[model samples]
Target chain A: MPNTLILSIDAMGGDHGPSVVIPAVDIAARQLGDVRFLLHGDQAQIEAELAKAPAARAASEIRHADKAIAMDEKPAQAMRRGKGSSVWNAVEAVKDGQAAAAVSAGNTGALMAISMLVLRMAEGIKRPAIVASWPTMNGISAVLDVGANVESDAEQLVEFAIMGAAFHHAVHGSTKPTVGLLNVGSEEQKGHEEVREAHALLRANSFDFDYRGFVEGNDIAKGTVDVIVTDGFTGNVALKTAEGLARFFGNELRATFKSGPLAMLGAVFASGALGAMRKRMDPGAVNGGPLLGLNGIVVKSHGGADAPGYAAAIRVAADLARSDFTAEIDRNIRRLGAVVSESAASPAEGAAE
Target chain B: MPNTLILSIDAMGGDHGPSVVIPAVDIAARQLGDVRFLLHGDQAQIEAELAKAPAARAASEIRHADKAIAMDEKPAQAMRRGKGSSVWNAVEAVKDGQAAAAVSAGNTGALMAISMLVLRMAEGIKRPAIVASWPTMNGISAVLDVGANVESDAEQLVEFAIMGAAFHHAVHGSTKPTVGLLNVGSEEQKGHEEVREAHALLRANSFDFDYRGFVEGNDIAKGTVDVIVTDGFTGNVALKTAEGLARFFGNELRATFKSGPLAMLGAVFASGALGAMRKRMDPGAVNGGPLLGLNGIVVKSHGGADAPGYAAAIRVAADLARSDFTAEIDRNIRRLGAVVSESAASPAEGAAE
Candidate 1:
C-alpha cells in the first residue's frame, strides 16, 4: 500500500465468499501489477483461501470483519444494522482513501445502500446510477441507470448521459463518446414525457460528450452510440431481456444439437467455431457494473460469477481507479448545473433544460 | 358479409402493398374457410394481384380508394387528411360491421391513430394497448402495451392485464392466463410508483386472469407467466431489446458457420435441425399485433413482413373475431370499474387502488 493502487475486497461477500474472492484476486493480480488488495472478511477463512493463491497472498492484507451481510437483506435494514460488516468495511476502505475502489459480490441493494452511505453522492447527483458494459456487435457500449434509481426525471437522465459518457471515455477509452437517450423511436415526438424531455435537454446542451438524439432498444446491440441513457427501470428491463433472450438462444441451440444424430455429428465438427461463439456470448467476459455518481469508486460483480468473472469486475474497478473518472464527472456535472441554471433563468430556453 | 366472416385488407398499406397482401389473403383463405375479404386500395392493382391469387380473387371484393397513407406520414397529419385512404377504408369496413376485423401491413403510427379515431375506445378503456405474441420456451406468452401508451398509470396497467389475459385466452386458448406485472424486482417495494401501484392493484383484484406477483425481465423468456403487463415504454423497450439480441445471436451463428470450411461442412450436416431452429426463432411466424381495447378488432402486420407473415396477421384477426374476445373484455373491464369504485370508496383498501 506504500505507492501501489489499493482495491478493497469484500472477501465474505457473494455465495462462495473467500473461495471465489481469493482466486479472483490472484487472477486480477497477474493482470494488474503493483495493485494491493485490502481484504475485508473473517481473517481465518480469508487467510486459508489466500494461502492457496500465492500471488494474492503476496499482494493482500487482511482486514478482519465480524459479520457479512446476507444476500437477501433489505437495503434499508442493511444500511441501519450493517456497520462493521464485510461489505461495509470494504466500502469504508475506499472512503478512508486506503483503497481507490471497492469490489463486491454482495447483494446489489445492500452494496448500493452501503456504498451510497459511505461514499455519498458526487457533487450534484441526486441519485447514483449503476452503469453496465453492454456487449454490442461493434464492441461494448455503456448503458446507465441499470438498476440504481427506479425512476429518473429528465435532469437525472441528462446526468446519466454525462456520467455514462465520461465513464465510457475513461474505462473504454473512447475519445468522444456519443450518447443517446433510450426511447421507443428515434422521432422527436415519440416515447413518454421523461424520455422526450431528456431528448430535448441532451440536444439543447453543448455537453462535452456528443449527443446522438434518441435511439431505440435495437440500437443498443447495434452499437449506435457509446452511451445509452435511460431511467433505471427501463434500462434494467432492457438488460435483463437481452440476457434472457441470449440464454434462450443458447438453450435452444444446445437442444437442437442434441435432438438428432446428424446434429450431434455436426456439433463435433463445429465445436471449435461454436466454442468461439459461446465465448463471444459469455456474460463472464464482461461481468462488472460500476456504481456511478458515488464520490468513491465501487464495482459490483455478479453474485453467481466465477473467478474469471470476479476478476473482470476487479479489472473494471482498477480501470476507474487509474483514470480521471471522478474529475471528468465533476466537470460535466458542473457544466450541467450551469446549463440548468441558465434554462431556469430563461423560460423559453427549452422544455427539459 | 352474408353469414361469412369478413376480413378487411389494406391493400396499399405496407412496403410491398397488394403484391404481399393478395397472396397473404390467398394463403389465409385456404386456412380460414368461409371467410370473405373486403379489399381496400387501388382496384386495378388489387385486381391484377388477385388474378394471380385465385383463392384471394374468389374470396375478396375490391373497394377502390383514391389514396394510400404514406409510410412516413405523421399520425396527426394522417388522421387530419386521410379520409378516403386505403387504411381508413379498411378500418371503416370493420366499423360498418362489414368485416369481423381489419388486417393491415401498414405503418403502426398511422394504423393506431386511424383505428382509434374510427373504432373509438371500447366501453371503459381510456387508452388502447398493442398486444404482441412473444415466443417463449414454454410455447408463446402475451406481452402488452408493446407501444401504445408510453406512460400508463396503475389503472391502465391493470386494464392491460385484463385485456392481455382475455386476448391470450381468445387467441391462444389459455383458460386462465397467468399475468405478471413487469418490474425491476419481485420485492413489494421495488420499481417506480406506477409499477408498484399496478402490482398492488393486480394482487388485490380478482380478475379472470391469475395474477402472479411482480416479475423481472429474465422471467419473460422463462415463461414465468402467460401474460406480462407493462407500460408501453418498458414493454416496447423489452420487446425490441429481445429482438435485437435474437438478431445478434442469429448473425453470430451465421458468421460462426461461415468462418471456415469445417464449420461450413458442419452447417451442411446440421442444416435440417438448424432450419427447424430458425423457424422457431422466426419473427414472421408471430408477426401480428392486435390493438386491444378498441370497439372493433384491428390487427397490424409488420410493415416488412412477407406473405406468410401477413397471413399470420390475418389468422390472428380471424381468431380474435371468431371468439368472444370483445364480450370477455367488456365483462372484465366492467368488473375493474366496480373494483376501482369500491376501492375509492374505502380509503384504506390498497396503495394502488
Candidate 2:
C-alpha cells in the first residue's frame, strides 16, 4: 500500500456483491499494474471470491465491514446510521489516505451521502456533481451534474463547466476541453432564465476550459462539445432519455430482424455487422459514472453492471487516482473566483482549501 | 371540396416552402383518398409546384398571400406585422371553417402565435400545449407541453394530462390513455414541487385518462404510459435529447458496418433488415406534432422534414379533423376544473364555450 496505487472497494455493494467486485478488481489489477485493492465487506465471502483470482488475492487485503447499505435506503438514513458500513468504510479509506480513490455499486443517494460525509466537497464547490461518460459519435463526452443537485442557478452551472472539463481532462487527457451549457436551444430567447444567464456569463468570461457558448439537446450526441454543463434536473433527464432511446433503438433493431422468415434470413447473413453494432453501443461497454467535485475521487459503477462493467468503473477510479485530478480541480476552482467566493464562508470550504 | 376533408396548408412556412408543401399535399391526397387542400402562399410559387403533382392540383385551391413569415421571426413580431402572410391565412382558413384543421412546417413560435390569434384556445384550457408522438419500445406514446409553455404549475400539468390523453385517444383510438407526470425519479419526492403536486392531483382525482403516478425520463421511451405530462422546458429537452440519441444510434450503426470488409459484406446481406429498422424508427415515418388545446386542430411538421415527413404531418391533421378531437379536449378540460378556473377569464375561453 505504501508504494502501490490503492483503491478501496465496497465489496458488499451491488447486486452480485463479492462475486462481481472480486472479478472486476482482478481485471482492473491485471490491466493497471501495481494497484492494490482494499476490499471492505464480509471477510469470509470476499476471501472465497478472492481465492479464484490469485493475482487479486496477492495484491489485495480485506477490511471487514459489519453492515451493507440497502439499495433502497434513504440518503438521510444512510448518513445517520451508516457508520462502519461497507460503503462508509470504503469512502473512509480514501479520507484516511489508505486508498487514493473509492469505487462502489451501492445506492447512489447512499453512496453520495457517505462520500460527502467522509471525503467532503472540494474547496469552493457549492455541491458535488455526478458526471457520466456519454458515448457520442466522436468517442465520449462528459456530462454533469447527472443528479447531484436537484436544481442549479447561473453560478452553479458555471461551476459545473469547470468541474466537467476537469473530469474530461483527467480521464481523456484532453487539455482545453470544449465545454457547452446544455440548453433547449442555442437561441438567446430560448431556455430557462438561469440557463440564459449561465450562457451569458460563460461567454463573457474565460475559464481554464474552452467555453463553447450554448448548445442544444441535439448537439449532445453530435459530440458538439467535450463537456456538457447543465442543472442536475435537465442533465439527469437528458442522460436517462438518451439511455431509454438507445435501448429502444437496440430493441427495435432486434425485433425487426425477428419479425419474419425473410428478416431472420437477412439476420443470419448480416450477423457480424449487427453484432458489431450491438457491441459498439452496449451500455455495459461503458458503465461507470465518476462522482466528481469531491475532495477525493469516487467511481460509481452501475448496480446491475457485470464483471467487465464493474472493471470499467474500477479502472476509472484508478485513472483518476493516477492523474493530478484533485489538484487540478482545486486550481480550476481558484481560477473561477466568483463561484467559490459566493460559498466561500463554509467550514468545508476552508478545510478543503 | 364539398364532400372531401379539407386541410389548410401554410405553403410559405418551412425551409423549402412551396417545394415541400405542394409535394406533401400531393402525397397526402393520394394517401387519404378523399382530401382537399387549401394552399396559402405566393400564388406564382404555389402554381409552379402544383403543376408537378396533378393529384394536388386537382384536389387543391391556391390562395395568394402577400407576405411569407420568415422562419426566424419572433412570435410576437410575426403576430404584430404578419397579417395576410401564408401562415396567417392558413390559420384563418381554420377560423373561417373552410378547413377542419391546419398543417404547417414553419417557425414553431410563429405558427403557435398565428394559430392562437386566429383559432384561439379551447374552452377552459389555460394555455395550449404542443403534443407530439414519442416513439417508444412498446408503441408510440404522446408527450405534451413540448416547448409550448416554458414553465407550468401543477394545474397546467393536470391540463396537459387531459390534453395529452385526449390527443392520444383521437390519434391512436385508445379509450383510456394512461397518463404519467414526468419526473426525475419514480419516487414521490423526486421532481419539481409542481410535478409532485400534479402527481397527487392526478392520482387523487379520476379523469378520462388512466392516471398512473410519477415516472422518470427513462419511462418516456419505455411506453410505460400512453401520455407523459411535463412542463415545456423539461419535455422539450427530453424530446430533443431522444432525437439526438436516435440519430446518434443510426449514425453509429452505419459507421460500424462501414468499418471493415467483413462488416460491410454483412451489411449488404442484412440490408433488408437494416432498412426496415431505419424505416420503422425514422422520425419522418411519424412526423406530426398536434398543437393541442386550440379550438381548431393545428399540426406542425418538422421544418426540415422532407416529402414523406410533411405528408405524414398533413395526414395527422386529416386524422384529427376527421375525429372529434376538439370536443374531447373541451370535455376533458371541463373535468379538470382547477386548471381552467385559474385562467378561465381569457377571451378564447369565452369564444370556445
Candidate 3:
C-alpha cells in the first residue's frame, strides 16, 4: 500500500476562506492520488463547503478552530493572540506529525510568524524565504526570497539559493539544477558588495546546484537558470512587476483587437489562437509556490486566487509533502553549512547599520 | 525663424556608429522642424554617412574628435582617457552653450561619467538619474534613478521625484504629475527605514509633483502615478525586469498560436489585430527617455537601437532642449531642497556600517 501524504489546510485564511479551500482540496485530491487532509477552521462552514466537494469531504477530517487570524494583524499580534486559530492549528498539525505539510493563502506576516513559531526553523537554515513560481519562455523557474526577509546579507542570500535549489529538485525532478544570483548587471563588478560576496561564495562553495554566476532581470523570464536567488525586497518587486507587465501586455493586445471592425473580424478568426495564449498565461495555472527553507512544506496561493488557482497551490503542497522534500533540504542545508563556514562574517558585512 | 534647438550628437557612439546616428539625425531634423546638430566624431566618417542623408547634411555641422570610448570601458577609464572623445566633446558642446542638449548611444556608465564631468551636477541635486519613459495602460509615465547610483538615501530619492516630475511636465505637459515611491509593499510599516523616511519626507515636502505615497511594482504598469521614484538599484532592476517580462510574454503568446493547425488558422484570421498589437508594443515606438537631474539635458538611446530608435532619442533631446526642461528641473530641485531640510540626518539613518 502506498503511504498516505496528509496536508493540513487553513480553511479560514484566504479572502474567500472555506468556499475556495474546500473545492481546491477536492481538485488537489483528484489530481494527486493517495492523499488525505486535516482541515482546520470553523467546522460548520467547512462542512457546508465540503458537502459541495464530495471527494474532499471523504478525504478530509475536519477539526474546529474557535478563531481565525485577521489579515491585517502583524506578526507580533499573531504570536500574541493567534493560538488555536486556523493557520496556527494547521501549522501545529504539521509539527505534531498529524499532517505532512501546511498550506495557507492567508496573511503572509501572520502565516510566516505562526509557522516559524510552531514548526521551528530547519536546523541549519537561518531564515526561510517565500518562493515564487515564475513563468518562463521555456518552462517555469522558481524565484525565492520574495518577501520573507526585507533585507538579506550574503549568507542569507546563499542560503536562499540552497533552499531554492533543493525545492526545485523536489518539485521539478532536476538532478543538477542550475542556479544564478539575480543582479542589476551580469558583470562581476556590478551590484552591491554583498551581491558580489554572494556570487563569489556560491561559485567557490561547491554548492548543490550548478551555479551559473550572475544573471540580470531579463534572465528571470528567459529561464536562464532553474533557480534565481536574491534578497526578498528585490525579488518581491520583480515578481509583482512581471505579473503586472504580463497583464498589461494582454490588456493592451485585446484593446488593439477591439479598436475597429476589421480588427474584430480578425479576432473571430483568431479566437482559437488567442484562446490558447490566454490559457497559457492564466495565473491559475501557476498560482502555487512553495515557501522553501522551512521545517515543513508550506505553499502560498495568491490572495485573490479562486478555487482553480487555490487548487494549484494545494497540488504543490501535496506533491512536496509526498516526496522526501523535507529530509532532502535538511541534508543539503547541513552540507551547505559545513562548506561555507564563513556564514558568521557575512551577516556583519551585509548589514546596513 | 523659429528658434533652432541645437543638439550635440556623439556620432561615434553605439554599435553601428555613424551609419545609425547620421540617418537618425536626419529623421529627427524632419520630425522636428526647428532643429540643428553639432555632430562630434571623425569628420571623414561622419561626412560619408551624412552624404546618404541630404537633409541631415543640410542641418548638421561636423566637429571632428580624435578619440572614441569603447562600449566595455568603465567610468573611471573614461574620466582618464575619454577627454576630446566623441562623447566627451559632445557633452562639452552642451557645457559651452553651443547646444542645448547632448544625445548619445554610447556606454551608459561612460556617458553618465563624461556628462557629469563636463555638465556638472545641477544645483541642489547630489546625483543625476536616468529616466525611462514607460508605456502604461493610459499613457507614458516616467520612472527614474534607473542606474545612476546603486544606492541612494532619502534625499536623493526625493530629488529623483522632483526631477522625474519636471521631465513628465516638460514632455507630457502635465502641470502636476503624480509621483509614487516604488516599494515592496504599499502599507505604511513595510520596506526599509530609508524608504519610510523618504515616504515621510515626500508627504511632508511641498513637492511640485502630487505625491501618491507608496506603490508596489504592479502599480507601475497600472499607471497609478505619472512619476515613479526609487533608489537606482531597485529602479534599474524593475525597469529591466518589466522589459524582459514583456518580451517573454510576446514570445510565449506567439508559440501558443503556432502550436497546431487549428491555432495556425486562427492566427491567420487574427493577423490584422495581431499586427496592430505588434505595432503598439514595438520598442522603437518609445525609444528615448531623458537622463534627468543634470546641468543640461542628455538623452541615452538603446545601445542596439536601429536608425528609427536612434531618431526617437534625438527627437527627445530636441524636445527637452526647447521645452526649458533643465530650468524647470533646476527650479523644482531648488524648491525641493528648501522643503526637505533634513538631508543631513538621512544617510546616517540608512547606512549599515
Model 2 Cα displacement at A193 (Å)? 1.0
Clashes of 1: 0
Error of 3 at B221 (Å): 0.6
> How many steric clashes does model 3 contain?
4
Q: Give candidate 2's chain B TM-score.
A: 0.91
Q: Over the stretch A320-345, how does candidate 3's per-residue lDDT look in tens digits?
A: 87676777677767766775775644
Give the runs in model 2 whose Cα sits over 4 Å from its true position. Answer: A1-3, A260-262, A282-285, A339-353, B1-4, B283-285, B338-353
By TM-score, the best candidate is 1
lDDT of 2 by residue, B1-353 (tens): 47689889999888999998888888888899888889999999999998899989999999999999998988889999989998899989999999889998889988998889888887877888898788777688898888888778887899899888888887877888998888778877676667766776676556888898888788887889999988887788777777777777778777876877766665666667777677666433578998888888899998988988899888888878887777777776676675445544322111000
> Each predicted complex: what DockQ?
0.59, 0.37, 0.51
Task: Rank candidates, DockQ, best first.
Answer: 1, 3, 2
Colliding pairs, model 3: A352-B351, A352-B352, A353-B352, A353-B353
List ranges where model 3 is wrong by over 4 Å: A282-285, A339-353, B282-285, B340-353
User: Candidate 2 falls in which docking quality class?
Assistant: acceptable
Best by lDDT: 1
Candidate 1 segments exceeding 4 Å error: A282-285, A345-353, B282-285, B345-353
* Tens-place lDDT digits, model 1, residues A98-179: 9999999999989999999988998898888999898888788999888897788888999999889988998899989999
Cα error of candidate 2 at position A121, Å: 2.4
